[model samples]
Target: MRNFWGLMRAYWFSSSWKEAWTLTVVIALLTALSSKAGVWFAEASGELINSIAFFHDAANTTPLTSLLENAAFLVGLVVIKDAGITGSRTYISATLHRRWRAWLDNRFNEALLDANHSHFHAQHGAGTPAPDNIDQRVQESIKDMTGGAIGLAMGVMAVATSLYFVGQKLISSSTEVAGLEFLGSYGSAVLAFVAVAVYVPLNTWIAVKLGGMLEQLSIRMQRAEGSYRGELTTLLRRSFHVAASRGEDVQKAMHERLYVDIDQTWGRHNIVSASYASFERVYNFVGARIVAYGPGLIPFVHNRIDLKGYITGAELVNALISQCSWFIHVMPAIATLRANSKRVIEVAVAIENVQKPDEFYRRTGRSEFRRTSQNPVFGLTIQNLELAHEGHDTTPFLAIDQLRFRRGEWIFLRGESGCGKTSLLKAINGLWPYGRGTIVLPEGVKSFYAAQDVRLPQVSLKEQVCLPDAPKDHSDARVAAALHKAGLGEFIEHLGDVTRQGKGWDQQLSGGQKQKLVVARILLQQPGLLFLDEASAALDPEGKIAFHQAIKDNCPNATVVSIMHEATPPRSASGTEFYDSVVTIADGTVIKKPLQPPLPAEITEILNRPAMRQPTRSPAMEEGWRRIARLRLKQK
Candidate 1:
């Protein structure tokens, strides 16, 4: 209960606190007005009904003409009140919902994408497994988190208003006994007190008891949904791979198992929900009415309240009961909130601050060069650095006793596949923290690491090139030059164009083309420290050579560390001694040297392009690009 309330009201303490409070107050006022309106309606309509019932009676001093006029005016006024107040309240509620959701999304996104790369760490860090189906949690649960709580709050206020007015009417005007007859006599009774002490408690107890079971089932249902959705999304993302393997049968079986979980979860939820509906909601409502009309059974009470008083009084009782009785209308919402609360909060908490270090974490090694009076270290320096996987720190796979690379050095990392080369790079980049030893990096250095498999966003070509920075901020000429230099000149003409018709970069680009795109990114970023963990392994032989040459040409001053597998040692295309040192890590040993370049061989593989169909260009369009190319060549 504490967690649930905290999650709901947390938005009020956020940066948008003023707005939150203001909207809440407005909603409260509207609820109070609506509650008071219900009482007025009950009283006025009761009198109206009495007047109409005995219209032609002689004892009825009230004329039909006056009565008709009052009825017309009262009904019209009530409608206008509803239109004015209810409409405003609804719109405000929707606005608050949207703003709250937007704020949550912004907050979550900012925390994940912070300078610390909290998102990455949240998924891979040593601790409880990361939250699953984050998008589903955000979409499904967030709606009711704020909206339902606000509604529940307003419902409380409305009930209070109703109780005060309706109870006052019965107490002050009737022959007491709360307007009910008992043992042929009447005595004073506190209708509000009785309802709060007896009726509300019973109703709430029943609701909570039944809804408790439903809450658990609701949690399971939501989990199943999130898991199912998450898997479907993953399969769709790797749809090409799945299709290439012709593993539809396997995929179907996997999806079927996941779907069965959903089906079973739904069945469990429905069982509890059905019980809740029959007992708590339907029976409770009916039983309450039976108890309520005991007053109406009395001659005097019946004459006074009639059916109208019963209804209006109910609005007050219902205002409070609505909080507990809410299951009737939004049981699933409450369940979803309870279930997804952990999921959504897990991400928020993890992203907001670093998780408290657990037993698995043992990295007291990495040390940054803090800026002091004098300039900090100029480049990266590792001392007794060791690397291991997060959970398997017992088996240290690689160790670097001492290695130093100064500014403007192109370092090659050569090793066999799975020789912990990538893990070493990750440790250097502050990613792996399982082993021991200090790795001091240059202070305030712009860094970019193109991992072996980097997932690019579905964005414009220019945006893709200028990622981790605003694409709009970069000039088309500089971006175009970078693209052309990386041998992606074919895409330069439409550099501004994004993927179309649902075909994203994933579907459009071949492996080699995608690697060239990475080269374009390195050119654009020109980071002070760059780490390429086999970033060019997908490219052909010529493409690989050209990749190195392009980097040397563009980002000449930056320190580069390229990971090269044993099958493909680092090569300098220009034959001008670009690589400063080749460090090979193999069988728990490190070899550092600079070997002479190998003789030119019969290399035949050319650049591999994507399968995307080229845009049909008119003769004029072809000539226009040709002219541009000629002009650039002439100017150079």
Candidate 2:
């Protein structure tokens, strides 16, 4: 219950709260006005009937002109009431819907993507497992929350207005008849209160039970749908691999299982829906008649209120309007309120659960390391770092007592498969938190991680290459040059064409081409620190060497950390001496070794090359070299 309110408060106090509240208030006011108009219309209709009957019984006593005037006014009220209701509903669905969804999407993104608090993509075996059906939760469940919340609010307002106006009319107009004093003035209101007191608890119980079942069904449906969609995505992305392995049968079997699960869950859902429909139909039909006629019948059975008399028209109109009021204003509101509340509550609880650190620790039974920021310093530092997969206390995956890398150093990190190489990269990048460690890097240093499997958005190639930064920041010439250096010169002409026709780049490019694109992006951005996790695994040996040389030549000042399974020896003297150190990780520990400097002969060859003397090194290195030269001059 506390969590539910917390979720509500989070959304209600969000940046768009003022706009959301204004819209809600407008909707509520319109609902109240419409309800009042409807009740006034009903009362005017009864009065008009009584007036016409009086004129018919004694034509000289009541004027026909007055009856006509009342009829005209009632008709106008009906039109105005309907128009206002329609306008309110339309505005809520259109304008308010967009506003609320925009706010929710942004908030969800912040909670899911924030570097400090996000557990949305935490690994399954790590801190806290991510929630299932996140796509559905963000898209469908948010829609349900907004729509249900507004509907429930408007419904309650309409019901309250109807009850006050209708109860007042019945209490003031009813009278004693046939010596039955209890069935006198206010009898209709008394009977309505009694009937409602009996009906609300009974219907509320059934509605609550049905709502719980529906919530479960909604979750099951999303799971089945998400599973099927995930399979389809995999099939599309790995079509070549599937066909090569003849795994089509296995894929088909999986599809069949997902469909069967969907069918079974939907079958149960249909049964629950049908049961609710049956109960609602029967209850409304019987309940409306009893509440409408029970008071009128008592007067008639006691030989007081007579049909075919002057009072008959008013009495009959009263009963009919009373029944319509319950049907139109009360029953549907209660029903929708129940179902929508259930859905909204479920989604709200999920959002709250995902955002809480305590929940994550309780679920995984693991303590999470707190992320901290410190003053800027040169290079990188790590002290007593220890990392293990969540829920495991066995041998740690990667452990280091102390390590440091100086500024502008090129380091190669080598390890076999499943050697915690990428895991360490993630830990350094602040993506993994299920570890104990202190890693201090230069404050506010821009860093980029190029993963093995590159993800490209469904945009033009120009946008894809210059991502995480606006395309306007880089000229077309620079983008083309970067692509050419990465060996994608052929794609230069197709830059304007959307990748995969705006479907996704995954289907358009081969694995090797994707790797080159990632490298191309890294060269384009030129961050201060670059971590490459097998970014060249898909390329041939020659291609890998060429790309490595390009990184060294293009971004000389950038501190490069490459994680590779197979190390390719550099061909040129300049390339061979590029890396300052090599680090090997084995059996959960690291061994670092400094590289031997280039020989005098190799240095002479590099010096002879005009392109190598362009001074691509950082200013810090230039200053250090100038100091060395000055010392040599003084000695001479």
Candidate 3:
């Protein structure tokens, strides 16, 4: 009950909570007033019936006339009151449901961004899906949780109202007789009161158990859907090798488990429904028998007293009506209230998990540096660095003993897949899980990371190249230069206006074009320390060489660290040495190698032409008969 109340209180702090509260208050008033009217009519009818039965010895007339008149009047009033209540309840309930759902979606969207920053990739358990795909939970689980809580609350309220009226009517007529008739009716009312104590707890327990089963079933349903969709793609693509190697029999067996889990959960729900149905049936039966027939039974037992001493048939009917009135008056409201309450709890739990952990890392305010600092010496240094997950101790994902990138240096990290190459890059950029280490990025140092697959938004060609907020005028010229350097000059030239249907960046760009656009974006960014993860793989050999030269031209003093399968040209005598230090990894161990010139055999073959060692023409120049060789020969 305390948890349920807490859930309701949480909604008060949400965006649309004030409107929800106003609607709730309106629903509550209509419910209370309608309920009061029913109770009053029942009490008035009981009084009129008692008068007729008591005056039977003193020229008593027919009691049917009074009973019919009161019944008709009460019935008419109930019709009008219920109409208003129903309309008001529908409008309010619909508003509350929609607003609450919208609030949950907003929270989930916020969690996606927040959790991504906090390194929540593996936060969901192994069998569970990623946290960002929690859309199903937000849409479905929250609805069920809220519905269950509301139903439980409204059920309690209805039961309370029914018992209150029945209890008063029974106690008032308890002294009417000394026979078994009185005992039969009064004893049943006592039993009904005791049953309320016993069955309410039992039903509450059943509901909670059923709710757990439903939540589990919902998760299984999602897993099955994802599996089915994945398998369908594999089947269409004729990727049967994976299935054949695992044995198609095993795949079918795996699917059967999901089906069985959902089946078993639905089976348990039947037991819950049966338990509730049985309790309601018994409560209604006993209340009617005790309130309607118990008082009339006493008239036959005590012959000395008039029908007044006991209760007339009309009074007995009114008492029964009062006892059963809550079924109409209170049940629906309590049900809705319980359902809303549970949804509120689920939202609160998700929000709390994402919002906490403020003590860990908060971005501190500092003035931005305009240029890269050169004060830090040109030597790599690493003090202490360690990587450990929250609950594990033995093994770690990344173990950076001590490492750093010196200013104006080119460092190459080469390693096998999953040998922590990507993880190391993430750690350097502060994207991985937090660890105990102090990374003093020199005062004006800026870092840029290009992941394996470039991420491009579905925007115009210029926007994709320059990012959304970049200046439109500057983007056009810079994008052209970057594309030309990367050998994507023809592609960009054809995609002139990104807004036109066939010419739009998103409409015409391929995977390779998108990769080139990312390089263009970075060229424009010109960060101090550029971390490239196979960034130039989309380009040809000549394009790759030009791309490297363009980086040196754009950010002359910046340090570059790259993960590459191909090596750049070795240190030259006249030209600048592109990469001074090369760190290679073969078996998870870093090997520092000297940047030596080409082998003797290769140099002997290239001695025929001096231009072979150092090309005079620009890399972007096309090959033809009227080349630099022809021009140099004529000058000689």
TM-score of structure candidate 2: 0.80
- lDDT per residue (tens digit) for residues 1-636 in model 2: 224445445555777789878876777777667766766776666666766666667554546777888788878877777776757666765677678767776776666666544544332322433555566666766676566555555666666766666566556655554444665655544554565656656666676677667667766776788788878877887889899999999989989999998999999988977787787776666655554456556565665545322133233334334433343333333444343334445444455564555345435533444444454446777777877765645456789887777767888888778888888888888655456778777667678899888767678888888987788999989999999998888888877778555556666888899988887898899887889888888888787888788888898777878887676334443446667888888999998889655445544554446653556768776556545545554576
Clash total of candidate 2 = 0
TM, every model: 0.83, 0.80, 0.61
Q: Model 3 clash tally?
A: 16
Q: lDDT score, residue 373, model 1?
A: 21
Question: Which regions of candidate 3 deviate over 4 angstroms?
Answer: 1-8, 13-20, 37-79, 119-133, 151-257, 267-382, 386-402, 406-410, 434-436, 442-447, 453-514, 520-529, 535-559, 567-581, 586-636
Candidate 2 residues lying further than 4 Å off, grouped into runs, are 9-12, 44-78, 117-129, 177-184, 301-378, 493-497, 500-503, 567-578, 595-636
lDDT of 2 at 208: 65
Q: How does candidate 3 fare on TM-score? A: 0.61
- Candidate 3, 1-636: lDDT as tens digits: 126656555565666678767766665565555555555555555555565554444554655666566667657665665676546665666666666656655665565446345324324222223343244445655566555444344434434543554456545544433544445546434533444445445544554554554444444444455455555544534335556687667667755765675566556645644554565566556545554554445344556334443343324344445434444333333443444344444444444443433222222111111112234554334435544444323245444455666777777677767666665566566554444454556665666777656655446555666653455546577777766765567756543454545544544555566666666767767777788888767666655566677777778767777887664542333345677677665554455565654434433443445546545655545233225545555576
The best-first sequence of candidates by TM-score reads 1, 2, 3
lDDT of candidate 1 over 1-636, digit per residue (tens): 125566677789987999989988898888777766665665666656666766877987767875887598678768955897788888988888889888877777776677776777667545556677667666667765667655656656766666666566655544434334462222322443454457656666666766677778877777788888888888977888999999999999999999999998788778877776676656456545654444344433535445444443444444434433444445445655566676677667655445332222433323222212212345888888766655542567787788877788888888777888887887777676567677777777788898777676778888989987898779999899989999989888877677845578766777788888998998988887899888988877777788888888888778888886545454665555667878888997677776444432211111112321237767776556545545554576
- Candidate 3, residue 306: Cα displacement in angstroms equals 12
Candidate 2 yields a Cα-based lDDT of 0.67
> lDDT per model, in order?
0.68, 0.67, 0.53
